[model samples]
Target chain A: MSGNNDYTQIDNLLREDRMPHIWCPGCGLGSVLHSFLTALNKSEVPLDKVSVVSGIGCTGRTAGYVKLDSFHTTHGRAIPFATGLKLANPELKVIVFSGDGDIGSIGGNHLIHAARRNMDLTVICVNNFIYGMTGGQVAPTTPLNARTSTSPYGCFDRPFNLPKLVTAAGATYVARWTAMHVRRLEKAIVEALLKPGFSFVEVIAPCPTQYGRKNRQSTGLAQMDYYKENSIIKHGADTKDVDIDLNGQIVIGKFVDIECPTFYDLQTEILGKTFPHMSKTQAEEASA
Target chain B: MSRDGQLVGEFFMNGDVASAEGAICAGCRFFAGYPITPATEVAERMAERLPEVGGTFIQMEDEIASMAAILGGSWGGVKSMTSTSGPGFSLMMENLGLGAMTETPCVVVNIQRAGPSTGLPTLTQQGDMMQARWGSHGLYGTIAIAPSSPQEMFELTITAFNLSEKYRTPVLIMSDESVGHMSEKVVIPPMEQIEIFPRRKPTVPVDEYLPFKADADLVPPMGNAGEGYRFHVTGLTHDERGYPDMTAEAQDKLVRRLLDKIELNKDDIIILEEDGIDGAEVVVCSYGISARVALLAVKAAREEGIKVGILRLVTVWPFPDQKIKEIAKKIRAFVVPELNAGQVVLEVERCAGGAAETILVPHMGGAVHDPDVILEAIRKGSK
Candidate 1:
């Protein structure tokens, strides 16, 4: 809390000294981080037992700012790192806070595999639609025909419908929200934090310096206005219908929430059946 | 058997299986690996044996995930390891840098095959020696041990784990296909006879702990993920508090300590075995499978009445520069033999510093060196 500005309520969870964060003036990463911290505060889980993991990007800096046992891992590898963390210490509540490019492109294999295994983790992905830190390159979530540093002629490639992708990949909980929907996003995060298996919440946020200015939404407020106009909250909507396009209707809601035995639960059950004398506690003690 | 049911007896096993057994004996309770040639047996063995020992074995999506997983497992307060070959090792380089920067303790085994890019999947090569040293993009020191046999693979994997724990850095066991697949008798000692080095834990309360604050030994005590010590770690240039400090000064302080932690302790970390070096005219310098071949050449040179000796490098990185320098001053010439075209020999030539003639016996590397080729180099070196 020893800093120039005094925001006492949120200061306990933030590394204020690392402030003057690297996000752009009109960027929405700050809002997403704030919502995450608030949701973390509201959850009953012990802060000391919670570990935050992030990959490389503007959003990845979230791990550095959080005052927890956080890991700022390699680009696209946060899910795997968090997977290891959760598997090694089942008592720990592991959360991955990264960006769409990191979780969808190079790290897509791990993302799908983790979901397929139904790993017990909460993943918060900020989809800015462009690679912000790398100067607005086309990202996997970049809408078709969106102008980018690499795609000056307007990108023609198909962007992934992440909600549909994760839902198909077997994520037990899936949701999407814009940064404009603060309360709703916070609530989604809280629910994801409480869920038992492979919970994913995608926050569609503004990258004013990157995706925004190029797409004519030059300010965060303008992007918020866009969300206010175009976003539709359809809870229980079919995940297949959640595709986003430029100036098109953006579907946002809690699309999936069901349950299955998590990776650990299944692993422990199989091991216990195999080794009759082996209980979870006995296994942990043996490891110790 | 130990509490983990690790067998305690001598048995014939390949280097990969022995490596897994060695890790289990060293108290490594977490393994994350992918299936790759000459190294997949390590993963297969772990998959079969880890469950019996109450350890966890996860076959990750790829080498990148495997490497990242072990780092995560290490932070969760377990000894963790991974095994891979050329392509997988290439995939692991980025996260290996992450492990070094974060100072996470883990072991990485590279059962190398000939490769510029998957050249020969089932053949032997010692080409990765340089990659093991400088593959990751950064200024950092590395610890890599080269094992010549199944016995050495078992013995040195345990050593790799111990060094990794003591230094809080990722240690590499660089075994080539020849050693990795070769079968030999390995003695698994009783649990009481083996040594295990656990990570140094913080003595202070959670409030007083700084995650990256180094002790006098330049290694910080680590805390587990869920032990109520909510500390932060990142791959960025960070301060001792483990918070990102994007400054030249912070980079200088942190990078220097990361390098110095291993570099300054080179004497304690480097392992070299020497024989018949008292006033020898020529010394055959080599490691891994090539070291065994070079030893046969040295013995052949002795039979031919030439004054030649052998200097085998067990710990290949930290590069035995001082030892080579000292030997270069006394020897007439050095014959360096390796499966690669010429990797570690370059180190010998550089460390020799023009004090002695250095000859490289290069093999294209589908197989071990012809002993007579090294013997011929020894004869020329003696001349």
Candidate 2:
């Protein structure tokens, strides 16, 4: 970087006025967002045609910090909101950026449904393995035997295998990466953006304040070192084998990539049969 | 008129179906809802009809999703709506607050069923009156219209959209099971005759625009996603620039604006129908099916020389405080007949300010109030 005072390179894509974001120091959201913006720049989509929608969380704040037309919506509602945005104006590129607790726990219903419908959109879930915004509660993705504010003894319930869940629900593209793998994450994001159907990317991030402190890695730097030591990049690995274990290896790579007709494509195909009264102009409108 | 799939002639239809036609004629192009009893027909009609007009329809996983989707659709620059009953309306409360805080314009229809929980599903009652006003929580005000007939359902739905667009808030069409299921003749007016209120757009250039900045009307001009104005909106309390402001001072400004927009323009937004209220000693204050039921009681009481009048509330929110207070001065009593156990009567009693005796004639659920019970209340109230 040329000067500390300058942010001209990324300023076009960021709402710098809303800077000094609320994320704690050592949090990996900044780098995750960096990867996203880099991928956004490389994708060549027009800025005006893009919209970012986020549910309630620390990561949901990404919608506000981004310069694009964005919506910081209610808790656990980002997926359905993005679905509506895409269906209403089929031409706009709707992106859902939120957290594991928001999307995987409370929003789990909407996430699976969107995947099942094969809606065309991209979702980035930053997973820190705890509910960071609400002071580190046990999350749907918290590993068994991990300790949280709510699970002081240990989490007894099994956490979600996000890749297995979404892939089974019919997502066309799925990938996972850690904050340590910025280049790979950026490249995966670009590919997902170009994918035609539901594309999801889970970025295992460092929450120095919450999950890291409970586990051995108390600092964000320690969490990054843990990722460096534990993560294994295995592209095209089966999703069923990607469950995160408390003391085991972290499997990180692109998991599922396939093809299918999107929700809009199928909806447009059955227009005349379902909506028999469609006019000539309306046909083109729905087909958009 | 025919180009947009607007039905331009009269047709016999149920109130639920009439509501769907009204949405189409009012330029609503997107509908998101889940099927529920008493309100399912509205979604069924929209599924078949919205696609005909180039509108989009999606039955979400639940009412919560449905409510969130329509708010999303609204920011996408399309007028959107949803229909549900008591159970679904309860699920939609949180996102309804989201719509209020963000100032997203949309319509919600609740065909009331009786209950504190799921009292009577297939039956009719004028319940959910107070819930429509305060169900979503917070200190914001909402606009709700009561339709007593299928024709009024058609007309008031159009009014709902107009007020929503004009005020930039969620407008509720608080009809109940009886009117929603009852069939009647509804006129589909020509497109030109229908007054359409398009969403107000900010006239400023993109660089110069602040998303939540209010124009002279206190309601800000909204810009859609792809309109080149990169604006951000949130359910969190925000300043005029649409950035989240956690301070109470900022919140004070935001909440006051959300409420004051409707308060300052109450006269333009409220609609009331009154007959013989001027010289009457007793005025029946009612809405929705209760209003229609009161008609019979009012006539019967008038026949007995009680000088009773019917004050039908078309737009029920902002409480019509001034009008009720004014009318209370001339009338000896304001008798309220409702299917719920005294909801809207509370508002009447508060607005009456003890100038007139406000008597509540309540029926629990499953049926309308008998005309005689209301007549008895009228007689008791008149004394």
Which candidate number has the best DockQ? 1
For B14-105, candidate 1 gives per-residue lDDT tens digits of 99999999998998889999999989999999998888987899999999999999999999988999999999999999999999999999
- Measured against the true chain A, the candidates' chain A TM-scores are 0.93, 0.92
* TM-score list, all predictions: 0.96, 0.97
The Cα error of candidate 1 at residue B65, in Å, is: 0.7
Q: Give the Cα error of residue B356 in candidate 2, in Å.
A: 0.6
Tens-digit lDDT track of model 2 for B234-285 = 9898999899999999999999999999999999999999999989999999
Worst 10 residues of 2 chain A by lDDT: A1-10
C-alpha-based local distance difference test score of model 2: 0.91
Model 1: number of clashes? 0
Tell me how each candidate scores on DockQ against the true complex: 0.77, 0.74
Per-residue lDDT for A8-97 in model 2, tens only?
A: 256688889898999999999999999998788777777789999999989999999998899999999999989888878878889999
Q: What are the clashing pairs of model 2?
A: none
DockQ, cand. 2: 0.74
